[model samples]
Target: MKSYEEINEKIRAGRAVVVTAEEVIAIAKDIGVKEAARKIDVVTTGTFGIMCSSGAFLNFWHTKPKMKMQRVWLDDVPAYGGIAAVDCYLGATELPSYDPCNSHYPGSFRHGGGHVIEDLIAGKEIKLRAEAYGTDCYPLRSYEQNITLKDVREAFIFSPRNCYQNYNVATNCGAETVYTYMGVLKPHMGNIHYSSAGQLSPLLNDPYYRSIGIGTHIFLGGGEGFVAWPGTQHAPFDPRNERGIPLGGAGTLAVIGDMKQMDARFIRGVSLTGYGVSLMVGIGIPIPILDEDMLYYTTVEDADIQAPLCDYGKEGYPTGEPCVIGSLNYAELKSGEVDFQGKKIRTAPLSSYTKAVEIAETLKQWIVSGRFQLGQPSQLLPGGGSPDRKED
Candidate 1:
């Protein structure tokens, strides 16, 4: 009986090929049935599925003896829309209107719809109820070549934290709103800075032309465009103090408004920078953002002031450290005094990509070890897919 390593070497050397379930059992007999069974299960069911779903595969030359391989047969497996079953498991309470023209399900907001959020919120413990429709489950497609039995071994590998670090950065920094300003290409350049005269001048005729010119000194002598609280203040003359300006002419501009209302506008101008980076580095696994406890705040005018004032620094400012304003805050001017409300005004929380990467790596390890599952189904439908229907 050939050892597992020996069989693997033969496959790599193109001396042997993956055949079928029976052939796999034969190989396992050589390496001990228990070892063979474990390898077969991992390869055929675990690894193959992942590769197929993610569209990533290991080359044959890189095959290891214990590694499982998949073979494609000309035969097709039973394939179903799996839509109804998926919807049921996902808690899709409503079905998307089927678009015959597109052959796509335009899902709805019902519990079993195809929305990613619904599934995420549902968590992994939810048992999906399968709904049967016909004798044919679903049409399965076959691969063009047979897989090596060894190549089918599925082992959970932990991805590094860097795999998900980019997502963390983008999400924390308002991924949808940041504009991408690559070099001379300002795709969504806003109403080219109008002067007091409201005249649209050529780039050369612009009032701050020199300010926008090469080496013209960003942020001016004083960090005029920069805005931050006293605790978060930038150096008066530091070039890097140019807050809200793009970095190296390849960053985004910060816009202040209600996030929900501005989400679309922000997404329009910005694209995720770390997406390409992650894919290139082979850390393209998707990582989910967990919902942590939320922090909330309440605002009141200074009790002592005769006129209600919202000014943070005025007598109305909270007694101790002033409450910080954040992306979620509300501000109003009452009686000509600025009143601010939200999480106390402070420096935006610095989300460390390093920490995010660590968590992601841990998740990957869990997945590889069969301790975790990826792409959990949800009960919610895709956004704007369908109206929430109450079933009696």
Candidate 2:
């Protein structure tokens, strides 16, 4: 088995050939996996899309008199103040909806915590406020001020979960156009939308924890990040087809990176018509050519990965509640149209393929310029780690 040590040495010697994931696949198809594995040192994968489970930690500088923040708000959007007296986690999905402000405004989510984070990264200022019960040691009860990324000691995006290994194909069987997170679902299954960069996703390429896991280096919103933990709802052992790729949403990752180093382009705040706000972050990871087996997995094409078509008509998308029709490979899914239920259905990607490629190319340049180095995961993901809850 090729070890990471050899790959670093090859890079250091300037003899390594680092190629984008697409190029690696093409090389594999042309020269076969064995030769491609021997000749290539790294294969970088990328995914740029709207990930709901994302947020950043902001250590708002302590105010005069030292207030123990019990409730935090940024540009009127609420933040989780349960962490530390001066620290809070601003979730991207946190809206500005207060008592009378419950989505009554034309665009409630136009400026959310995600927007604040984006503004901070863009070197702009954001208003911050906190409320606290007066304490003897820390007597400041309330405060209001403006802060930027530079004002915070700890400004980083610690996404609890991201890059779902696979996702269910979203479609509408109802008569009305449904606005959900999976983009706008046209009525009567007239259209379908799927997330993930298909073959270009890092975890999808790894499939198993063979390469990707905690401690793995990655490209996060144009900044370097790492896999901090097995993501929330991680299901590493989810049943897969013969190719070992998970069927629906499966294995995930918890990533963290410096918010200051991020770019506004890679950190966008989007407002869905009815669903609410979400962050579209760009992520890229380089897969080291550990061996022939790893190379073979990296060569996996869109045709090999498949997802289940779940009926979105049912509430909560309950397990086995709706019919599980035939599987559709990403090749068919990305065609902008597909045949489903004996009718032609239009398809679209909420994720940006152009951004995905840009991230991939950027990561490739990092490795080639010796600016980025690969890190081995501390451990493998917990297979079938999180399961559904049951009751009597």
Candidate 3:
């Protein structure tokens, strides 16, 4: 079996064979996993999509009079200022105070916390305003200033949930059109929307969480990051196919990295029509070929990955209860059309497959050029299974 140390040594010496997840699939198909494992050292996987649970932590340093911020606003988007003297957490889904959400039919939410984040990463100045109760030690009652990402003493993305292993395909079955996070779902199932890079998704490549765990280094928003923990609501013990990949939103990652090193292209702010604003972040993970089994797992194709179809209307996702219509594989979904109940419907991918490919290739280049080194996880994720094992 190949060890991480061995692969890292090769990477340093510029001898480790690295390939994107898509590329390795063909290689494994041609030469088989055992032979491919002997020839390959690492497989890079990626996903780029909307992750609403994303946010950033910023330490704006102390104001002139040292204010303990009780409430904070960045570009009118509220932030959680309960952390420290000058620390705040800006969530992607946080809307502006003036945002009249759904008061008049469908709201046109054009700006929010996500936009503020993008501006900061873009090296643009953002208006920062905070208020506090005057204390003897720190007497400042209010503070307002313009700050960029460079102005913050510390700034890093602390996304609580991202890179869903597998997610649902959303459609509308109600009488009227609905504007949901899945996008504007047409009534009577006129359209379908699905996110995830299918086989190129990081968790899909490492289905069992064997190689992806806490402390594992990854490419995040064009910079390096690490898996902080298993994401919120992480239910790894879900129904799976023979390949051990989850059938629905199962495994997720809580990741973090320096926001200063991030790129504006990968970290974009999205205003989802009637829905609130959210962040679309890019993430990529490199799985070291520790053995034949690890190499084999990376060979999963789009046909093997399945997503549950659910209605996004009142009878479905809105009532806190789900009505699972059925399941569809990625191969059929990616073909731009799908047949549901004998009716052909158009399918659109919210996630960017092209960007995912770029992320994977970029990570592969990093490893090959000895610019990136893989880090072993200090702890495995919550639930565990084997892709090679048969479900009893």
Q: TM-score: which candidate is best? A: 3
lDDT of 3 by residue, 1-392 (tens): 99889999999999999999999989988998889999999999999999989999999888887889999999999999998889999999999989998786588888998888889999999999999998998899998998888889999999999999999999999988999999999999999999999999999999999889999999999899999999998888889898887899999999999999999889899988778899999999999999998998899999999999999986899888867999999999999999999999999999999999999999999999999999999987887445544434
- lDDT per residue, candidate 2, 185-304, as tens digits? 767887888887988888777877677878989999989999999999887666787767888788888999999889998988877765678888999989998888788888878888
Candidate 1 wrong stretches, greater than 4 Å: 1-187, 190-355, 360-392
Question: Model 2: what TM-score?
Answer: 0.93
Residue 224 of model 2 has an lDDT of 95
Candidate 2 clash pair list: none
| lDDT score for candidate 3 against the true structure | 0.92
Indicate the TM-score of model 1.
0.17
Question: lDDT tens string, model 1, 1-392?
Answer: 33334433443454432222213324644675444433331111000000001111112222211212122111121112232322111111112233121233221112222121122222222221122322233332222334331332321111111111000001111212222111111112111110000000011011111111211111100111110111111111111111111111111111111111111110111111311101111111211111110000000111211111122321212245432222111112112222124222222111222322332343233334443322222222111111122222
- The reply for model 3, stretches above 4 Å from the true place, is 385-392
Q: Using Cα atoms with residue i matched to residue i, what is each candidate's TM-score against the true structure? A: 0.17, 0.93, 0.97
Worst 10 residues of 1 by lDDT: 291-300
